[model samples]
Target: MTLHRLILREIRHRKVNFALSVLGAAVAVAAVLSTVGALRAYDRETEAVIDEMEEATKAEMAKLEDEIRKSMKGLGFNLFIFPEGQDLSEVYAEGFASRTMPEEYVTKLAESGVVTVNHLLPSLTKKLEWPEQKRTVILIGVRGEVPIAHRSPKAPLIDPVEPGHLVMGYELHRSLGLKKGDTVTFMEREFTIDDTYEARGSKDDITLWMNLGECQEMLDMKGEINAIQALECNCATVDRLGEIRAELGEILPNTQIIETQSTALARAEARNQAAATSRAQIEAKEEQRARLRAEREKLAGWLLPVATLVSMIWIGLLAFINVRERLPEIGILRAIGVKGRTILGAFLGRAVLAGVVGGVIGVVVAKVVKLPSVDSGPIIESGEWIAAIVTAPLLAALAAWLPSLAAAQRDPAEVLRHD
Candidate 1:
């Protein structure tokens, strides 16, 4: 009889053992393929979520920037000019003395015809003592709208201040034991508080604001202003700022013109940096997740190879026992002129057939079974299935090699004598 027919007959007769061997190999393949599928799927999903969040964050930032740009309408032309002797950095020093500039400079700027001057607001500041309150007060004088006022949740738009009225900073109002309609004595003159503003979260928060004429009279510095904040008719741009600076240089050589864009850019850069930090944090989280998945997959990856080794061992053990039980049959076949190679092929062929069967079942189980750890359904790739199917039989063949050789080399004379 042919070796193929012989292997089929042997498998049919020992169906239970063959099925067990196939089942063992199938379980191993299923485990490996399933874990691989789940890990790949999870990685894809995590990247997708990260990408979506990044896009959403960018959109939100753009919307905020657009809103800020829109709200800044008709308000981007501020040019702060300070006297030459008083540097900008000196204003931040604890005991720095400030020098005032001539009030006639405002007239010179308007008269220079360099640019259209919309509003020329001159300001003065002085460090004063409120002896009754036992506190140092920052007294500010403004000829036009308050430069530091901004709309916030706690503070809304302020009404234009009348000449005699005083507006206290939000924190300053809280610190001073005074309120609207309360009388306060400064420089031997009594003045009533007209309004208390909300906290601006800056130096202005602790400052007191009043009319330019009142401050000039109180400080005894008439016709002398420390700084001038002007709103020009044209847009605030690099070119326009340069033109303004050149014009100011020609007219008021002792003053420095400061454009407001630097401060705006600083604020914008801070926000963008914050957004980038958040995005980095999110990406870090995703990367950590991916690393964990890889670790888990690495751990899980060992299971199938170990199972395959066990399956190979099991097949080897079965083949060995079969050879022992069928020694007389092998002896009879050899006696009847069957070649040793054919006998070896018969045993190895059986092992391969069992492996193929097991691999098929393993692929099916991996594709169907749902894992608790994996959120998505069973994921079995075609390549993984093919690898499992191909590797199983090869492993079985390798396992059966020694046993099959032993069977084929058995002396027919000794076996038939025992039979």
Candidate 2:
């Protein structure tokens, strides 16, 4: 007989058995699809959290650094006070004091085109005499680079202060109940509020700003500054700062130079530690997700086999009935000289066909139950879709094959004698 004729005859004779096996395979395929879907969802959730935290952390650090720079400048501006011989409460317009170098010293330094030997003044602690508290708030002196804000146009009260105007820390403003354009007395000198701005660090919160000259005069410390900060100029500027330090030491040397590199290094190390911790947390999270995924895969390994095993038992029972019912026909065919192996082949073929049909149906069922697309980031990366499709059908085929083989080997002559 032709292969088509054989196939038709085989399926027609065993239609019931074929139908049952198809049902079993279809169910097996559906189970496999569900397992793969769960894993993908977890993958996406972990990645999204990591990205947001990284961005926020960096922004916070930058904000802190910027705030520190502003506090320094504000302190520097406040240090603008009067000369040593000059009296306090005389100089006003918030400015710096220059040290009195001899005329020839200035001339020679100017000739070097490097050392500009002008009179550099020192600033002292500003004192805020609070009458109610009966205690003076000793204002900490900051270096140059303070952030100042002004009043808003509509409000003229809450605007961001511009440079050259003094701004107070937010808390300091609150404590004194001071607003924009209010004057606060410190070091016996009356400095205008000019404007009020929010605080960035500890110093700005408690300190008042004025010209360094005014600060020197008010504090009664003149022609000297606490520290000389360097601008990143050539080697000459660096060298000059060092030389000027010695000259100033001879003149009135009691100040110290703070090495910014150490501070910067410490800051960078802190940032590195933070980043490392973040990375560690992320790794731990990812590892946890990986562990969960591994568990899921293990569960799938058990479930696929278990589902196929249970499904195959049903198929085996169906195969047994089909074999029993057709035994008389099978015995007659054998007596009429048909081959035994051929009978076995025919039965096996029918089961295989049924299993394939069941697998296809199961796959169709899975396709019908589409997972709703989640908009969560990174949840559905590439390659996962490929895994889902390939695993489903193979599992279904296995479910049907093992049971049908057992049924195919039954003795037809013995079965024919059954009632």
Candidate 3:
């Protein structure tokens, strides 16, 4: 019979040994694949979070840029000066509440002949307690021209507020559930709502407007204003705006002159924060991946090797025992002129077949097993499967080496004499 037929007959008779070798290989492969799967899942989750942070930041920055740019047109290059420690993003979005400058600054700014401007509006802002809503509302006081309310053509413009009357923003009016002719108490005094003004998709829509003098009296800030908004001359360009900023710097050394380019600065700040968030996410994920890598290395370097080594020992012992049990058969084959190489090939072929079978079972176990603790399921790589398949047979051949050699070298004369 051919060596292939001989190997098949041997495997059929040693079914128990074949099954044991395959089971051992399967267990080792499953362990390694499970560790790898968890690490890949973590990597996927980290990427998702980083993508989300970037997307949200882009949307927010785009909206801010559009709103700020739209509000700047026909409004001239307005300069807003705020307190040094204040964040411009928050100030520009929601008007400043704390007094940043004295009322005398406005008078000095207007009187400065070196800096010629069309108009300057010195404004005071405070958060007034709303007992009904259990929150506070933004109250802005404009001393000079009310540019925003007047320029907005769609606004329901009101005549000058006579002391005890209030001009509310349309949004604020809707939020407070108030109407014209309604009385609201503020600073222990009640005032009649004169009308609601429209500012069209600006923060001004959420504010309450009053004359600067009346606001000061109500807030007890007699000679204090928080901000100064200046409308540049009609013929002014970007260079002229810079000249105006220089003049303001010489006049108000402690105050910062912020032009419309604050929008650009805001955009830059948003991008920087978005990049920082992405970096943080990547770093955090890398830390997690590092930990997983360490664990996988431990399994690969120690646990997997130990399991494989045990499998090799068990298979070698079984092969040696099989050689002893079939000594007479091997002797008879030798007497019939079978070469030692053919006998060795027959034994090694049986081992290789067992290895292949075991490798397949291991791959199946790796894929089918469920790990409840790991939220992301196992990832089975084709490379790993190929490696297991290719390596298992080689490992089996090595294990059966000594047994096959002993079987090949057995004395046929001594075996026949004993029989």
lDDT of each candidate versus the true structure: 0.72, 0.50, 0.70
Span of 10 residues, lowest total lDDT, candidate 3: 149-158
Lowest summed lDDT over 10 consecutive residues: which window, candidate 1? Answer: 148-157
Q: Order the candidate numbers by lDDT, best to worst.
A: 1, 3, 2
**lDDT (Cα) of model 1:** 0.72
Score candidate 3 by TM-score against the native: 0.55
Off by over 4 Å in 3: 32-244, 247-285, 370-373
Residue 135, model 2: lDDT of: 51
Candidate No. with top lDDT: 1
Reference-based lDDT, residue 74, model 1? 24
Clashes of each: 0, 42, 2
lDDT of 2: 0.50
- TM-score of decoy 2: 0.56
lDDT of 2 by residue, 194-277 (tens): 756576664556555555544555455554343333222112234544554444334332222222333333444555666677
Query: Residue 271 error for model 2, in Å?
Result: 2.1
Supply candidate 3's per-residue lDDT for 59. 76
Cα displacement (angstroms), candidate 1, residue 392, comes to 1.8
